[model samples]
Target: MHLKNALQKYPRLIVRALVHPTGIFQQIRQERAGTVLAYGLVIVLFNLIMTVLAAVSGLTPELMLPMAIASVLTVCIGIFWLHLFVYGLGGRNGVGTTCRVAVVGLTPTALLGWIPGVALVGFLWSVLLLYLGLQELQDLSKARAVLALVLVFGLPLLLLALLAAAPGFSVAWASPGRVTWV
Candidate 1:
């Protein structure tokens, strides 16, 4: 197929994946690793563009490269951590399936994450997609999927939120290599 036709399918895949995660994940194992990597990179590109636009408005545009780097690193780390959790929860589908689900789950946040309040909604939707997709792709029970999601994302966010909300929160030793949390 031509590159244009292949590229066109991604937008449709994004919509279809969001609406029917189970259907998409059901066939995830049959998908090629190259195609999955391309899809993930496309979603990451969307996320990077949105992040850069948001930064350009009021935040530091100078941080664009760093942000892009961090975004890619985050996806890599997220995939590994999510796969770790899925494996712990008795998921035997290997990292490729988990990788596909992770990329598919990112569609909502990648598409609309720069919209301020809508960003939260998009993030929640993305989380939901991840949860559903994990269950389907890993063949895990609902409870196990919830546990994995909570462990991978929920607890860290809760801690971060709590720390951010605390009065007079400060990180004292933030010179370089190490830092303390709130």
Candidate 2:
């Protein structure tokens, strides 16, 4: 496929992922008050844990404040992204609902160090959601599902690897070449 044609097909693919035959607006209409309250509580708890961890990690007040802000932003963006993947892209209500619940339920793990263990859980969850979403794509053949999976997982990993490999990446320290603090 030509690059222009491939790029042109992407928006339709994304729209298919974002809007459902059931009507995206209607799904929002059907959400219950209790569900909203529960979601609110989850967000609050997730942010609280992240804030505490940031403070404990010795992040300066200035940095902690911004990190907390970033954490909240990440959660919000994750919600929207998952919503698009599960509801808009995936046709089955249960899969989308479960994925959303799983993402929110797992947010407390943000307090964990940014190591492979922590990152892996998030990565696996995303992969599972993509698999579920792919299963719902009536229009996509198996070859397309494989391509989608590559696009979904590969780009993020590539970017992460690039960032990690970038020059000047270093662990922050109070003193250079000294393990002990005064």
Displacement of residue 87 (Cα, Å) in model 1 is: 0.6
Q: Write the per-residue lDDT of candidate 1 for residues 19-97, one digit (tens) a residue.
A: 7766766655566778778887888787787777777775434444465667688888999999999999999989988
Cα RMSD, each candidate: 4.9, 14.3
Among all windows of 10 consecutive residues in model 1, the one with the lowest summed lDDT is 58-67
The local distance difference test score of model 1 is: 0.79
TM-score of each: 0.78, 0.38
Residue pairs with backbone atoms closer than 3 Å in model 1 (clashes): none
Of the candidates shown, which would achieve the greatest TM-score relative to the real structure? 1
Give the Cα lDDT of each candidate.
0.79, 0.45
Question: Per-residue lDDT tens digits of candidate 2, residues 114-165?
Answer: 3324645644544543444344432344555446556544767899889768
